[model samples]
Target chain A: MSTKITNKEQVEAFLESYDTFLFDCDGVLWSGTHLLPHVVETIELLRSRGKRLIFVTNNSTKSRKAYTGKFAKFGITVSENEIFGSAYSSAVYLSKVLNFPKDKKVLVVGEKGIEEELESVGINYIGGTDPAYNVEATDASLASLARDESIGAVLCGLDLHLNYYKISKALLQIQDPNCHFLATNIDSTFPSAGRLLPGAGTIVGTLITSSGRTPVALGKPSDEMMNCVKEAYHLDPSKTCMVGDRLNTDMKFGEKGGLGTFMVLTGVDKEETILGTNPLVTPKFYADRLGLLYELLQNN
Target chain B: MSTKITNKEQVEAFLESYDTFLFDCDGVLWSGTHLLPHVVETIELLRSRGKRLIFVTNNSTKSRKAYTGKFAKFGITVSENEIFGSAYSSAVYLSKVLNFPKDKKVLVVGEKGIEEELESVGINYIGGTDPAYNVEATDASLASLARDESIGAVLCGLDLHLNYYKISKALLQIQDPNCHFLATNIDSTFPSAGRLLPGAGTIVGTLITSSGRTPVALGKPSDEMMNCVKEAYHLDPSKTCMVGDRLNTDMKFGEKGGLGTFMVLTGVDKEETILGTNPLVTPKFYADRLGLLYELLQNN
Candidate 1:
């Protein structure tokens, strides 16, 4: 059973319970371009009380550097190290955790963000946003595509230009058991421009079905992402709280990592989901919205 | 236990047992563009014996009409009605089984073959091979994509030009619980041009993940397809035998339909697969290749 925080005392107690806070951006803080009410003030309030804040997102379309600009638009100050997008986390997972071969290159099935992050981590890669893959696959063109044995890993993320040509090449490379199949995240849908669009998981699902192989997902609800963030920030799970909207990804991620979880109703899940008889996951604490904590703290 | 058809007596007994033969064309009759050894003679022998022949393939890339031309290329006589492609089966399934509304249209996430089959069935459709979906998905363009209430179903097949634009449109229409989600076939991989390429299942998998909905697959191994062919030809399951190269699809299709199954080692599966302790689907009879039956029948 999960507790529903209602009053000012509950909010204060919740805030005092955790020294570090991990936040999910898209639904909790904002939905696409517009920021949610009291989000900026809530962050300011957390900052004033000396709470450590880290922005963690499963969106792999943007790199950490690009994400800084998104925060800047919302009048929020965020450094690269303060944020952890799936693209950057995947890069870290490859370099630090897997210790990917220095010589072998990664075949990217994504966009510029994955490429930028891989480059930042000193990893060699090809095929992401490449002009050659943009063209339609022809018999002549497909025959020209032989397996590149040099590719040690296939990293997939959210790609706007996903085509059969890319998937065909990915299938050939992933046929080798020696080659690693990796996905930045397996988010089924991403809220973008006020609509739920197909996320990275949809793109990765194509390869999985075709290749008959499962990938090592390196995002939310996976231990790889939690371990990467924990090691980098040196945060204590006992004192850290994960605040997000989605139950499957955000709440499950927090529970799996042994951290306190707080759920908000602004995103994919509703109150009925948690209050339902058979909920997918249970959060330690939940509120109508993230802004409620800030509203309750207002000097009334 | 399956009986391995070895001598002339066994081959003669096999031929005498079945009045109808359902053949999977891709790996059985031919590999790619070239006819397999003795395939012509075997079909000719079957015809001379007054056996009913039907070429049933899970490949949805080509319609039955197009398949007739391929047979003509190999100097074999085949009519349109003698063939059953997944593309045509899906159309029939939608019209006869589901009784899709005449006013409603289908949103295609496939190729021209599906379009041609849908047209043959007098089903109105949009999207497949449409220039509108051939472009990249941008915020400006996607914002213009409002749900079309008239689309009653979303059909998926093997599409070489599959793009994010088409998928985004599919996710929107499929979100309406009233709209049906249909797939021509869910073949994971298809051998093409001397290589195994991703199949219709891979394309449908993308929509399945994003929409979080399973489609009513109207192809091999599904009772929908078996019923369609069985009713069309008025063939008895006991007198019919399914001849093919794959176990999971071809063999399973035969077993589930209560028809005799013959496994040929010319394609996906091998003797070891069936001879193994836990075979996916065991055929009633096995042969090294389909050509062996023709060779055995030639002798005294």
Candidate 2:
């Protein structure tokens, strides 16, 4: 059974249980631009107590550096190293882990974030933010549709400019079993302006079905992203606590990584979801919101 | 065992077995623009013998009327009623089988074919071929994204102008469990311009993943389409033969509908795929090509 933290002692004990905190950004720190109450103060309290913080977000629309700006906008002083957006993690996984070929380029089905992260890692890429691919496909236009032999991998992420032309070209390339099929994250939907929009998984889903192939998703709940973080920081999973709102991604990620899990009821999932029968991933501790930890400690 | 038709006796015996022949278009009639050699002659031979012909295609890009124009282009006289494209079948299924509410509209993630078929049946629709939905999605633009309550069903088919905006809106609408999620057909890839391009299944796949809902597919291999054809044509399954290229859609469709299955080796699957152990579906007869029916009769 998951314990619901209410008293000041419980909050203090929860804080003391882990030295490092991995937070899922969207629903935890802020929900569609409006920062949750006591978010900044709570992070500040965690930092003041000499705890390490890493922002883990499945939203591949923004790179690590771009997310730093988003953090600054909320009055949070988060460095580039602290932010692990799927885009950055994917780039790292491709270059560092997979040892992507030097002569080959990665075909992107995403926005500037994936492109930016790929460039930052000194990896050549195409498709994302490419004006040539922005046009609507016609039978005549697709007449010359062929695989680009230079493309070694097809990396799919959330793309606002997603079109048939990009995916059609992607399908041709990935059909070669030798070519790697990668997804930044498979999050079905992401909250946008208080509304949920189709996420990267939706974009990847098209290719998955058409190609009769599955892609290697390097995001939450996948040990790839966890390893990317663990290797970068050399942190002990047993001493790390994953604090997030979603059970499938955040809580499951923590549970799979052997990290302590703290569920906050301020995002996609709620309290009953954790306590209900057949819960997706039950957290060790649950609270009304992330701010409750700060509130309990400050009050008593 | 599948009988490989060769001589006059096998050809004549095959012809005498079935009065009505269901032919899968794309691979059977023509492969992309250039019609396969002796296709017209083969159809002429079937017509000469007083055999009924029904052109059934999973390619939802064209309506029955549009397909007639294509048939005319190839010197084949095929009326709209004799054509059963997935788009038209889906439209018929929605109106007749489901008895779709007259007050509601279908949100389409396809091309003019679906819109034309829906309009033919006097079913109101939005999204398909709509210039408004053709634009690329943006965070600012998707902020107001909400479900159109009037949309009772989301019918997905092959859409060349597929964009994130169309699917994002589709996900929001289908999120409502009351809304019917439908796919015209789930053919993975269609041979286009000597290349395989992502088909209708790819477009529907995005919503399937994001919405976490399975759509009611109305196409080949589906009993729904078979029932629609059976009710309309009043054909005897025992006297009908499904002649097509693909095993999964064509052979399985015929087998399930209690029709004789005849495999032609001009489309997606080759001879080895069918004769191979653990074949997806087995056909009652196999031929090198559809034109062999005419060739064997003419030469012998």
Candidate 3:
């Protein structure tokens, strides 16, 4: 797993391998409220190198128009096709793998992102329940789909008010061995109120905790959506190096599925990760942000 | 489960009837730092009411003397005898029960608090391997007793470094069923870096996740230490109201166990709770702090 970087020079020498790059949005480009300094330049530098680029974020809370608006405000110029989020990934995956029945009805257990994805794929969705709070069954209550095992798969995503009851229902449905447990992402927590708030990951963890089985992850680190990326682009994996700050999505996407992983210290990994935890899974090359990639290429 | 309140008084009225009050400390008092202002006064008022009070915290990190000193500074007075930390609870249960197979020794999964408790109970202990971050089985790594079937039990407490290897060892010693799987407490997480640090509750949750069995909780909500309080004070439960902030421990202790639960807002329960949640399993009477209790009683 060690992508041998004999030195900084060797890593710089091998920059021309990938024709396309996939970047993660959250930890790579910006955290919740701030963008990395070199984010805009990073994309331009890659484009100048004759490389295709896409910003893939698993967060479904924001739509493409919203993301585009946000990125434009950050002075990053990109086309609508350049941004691929989990909502698109889920929609694309479902479109290919198992065509929902003509009258497909899904009990939505997530937020707006999930609802839109299912709708695009020709599945009818039960309006998601309000965010649960103040109940023991909040976990169970969140997975409204679990009440009816007839639902083929429970599409998992972020739920703010996760509790035991929703977890109980999801676990119960999964125990039937007939139901599929598809989680949007397994990020343990997300930043909220300037404090880490329990995200889809914690709820997914609880479901797995109760069911004793890992979910079929729809977002990052799972190959479930990579096929969509390939099909959408009509491109080969060998020509792409995933570049992002988040390990679970971008880095894992690159490393696990046979692409180069470039970790920028800018976003998700944080200052704490400068000293790597899993060295084998470490980035092939890192820069302060995308702007430095241009300077390195020029020096080479 | 409603204690007959003839007047317009609330849950505190029932709690005031108890002669000997048991409290769960961690979530009930302070989440670790920043003492709730009324905590000292609440306990003082209870004492003034001739209530025999005990401070029972499930956290096994600190010793009895340590807590007694800390509380003294906050203006609440208590001796080492009045505190029952999970560390102390674990020791009491072991000494009275299996006794760790005499000379065979036992591995300790906790910190100095655990060591002190064991020594006080005449039980010998040693540190375990890798000293996992799992919060439970913190003592499972005890190299002195890990492979030894002669070791009667793997005594677990609040070790933050608990992990998978420890769980494997417990299963490895499955032939010796009497070799107990004792846990000090089942707190899901502790407050750390202002985020949820996985607690012994997560560790035990993992065990029940892996093995599908519940380990006997030896802390405040458990019958073991409550019996310890009963034995020590010769107290009557019907007259006892357990005042605490955390719902699962302090509140549940009084409510489910046939004691009136007084939930003070000063601890773990939220101000949003007054809006509605299970206030029965919550506190019968709610107060901003212990002072409110004093004011209510003093004015009456």
Interface RMSD of 2: 1.0
The best candidate by lDDT is: 1
Model 3 / residue A224 / CA error / Å: 1.8
The model with the greatest DockQ is 2
Per-residue alpha-carbon lDDT of model 3 for B166-265, expressed as tens digits?
5444433432566577778876655532333445665455444434346667886788767666666676778877877766667777666677666666
Error of 2 at B79 (Å): 1.6
Every prediction's TM-score for the first chain? Answer: 0.98, 0.98, 0.80
Evaluate all candidate structures by whole-model CA lDDT and list the values in order: 0.91, 0.90, 0.62
Clashes by residue pair, model 2: none
Better of 1 and 3 by DockQ: 1
Q: Once superposed on the true structure, which residue ranges of model 2 sit more than 4 Å away at CA?
A: none
**Stretch of 10 with least lDDT, candidate 3 chain A:** A133-142
Model 3 CA deviation exceeding 4 Å by range = A1-15, A127-146, A161-172, A191-195, A246-249, A268-280, A295-300, B1-300
Put down candidate 3 lDDT per residue, A169-219, tens digits, no spaces.
Answer: 454556556666677777655553233334566446655654556777777
Give the range of the ten consecutive residues with the poorest summed lDDT in model 1 chain B.
Answer: B137-146
Full-model lDDT, candidate 1: 0.91
Once superposed on the true structure, which residue ranges of model 1 sit more than 4 Å away at CA?
A: none
Q: What is every candidate's C-alpha DockQ against the true complex, given to 2 decimals?
A: 0.82, 0.83, 0.03
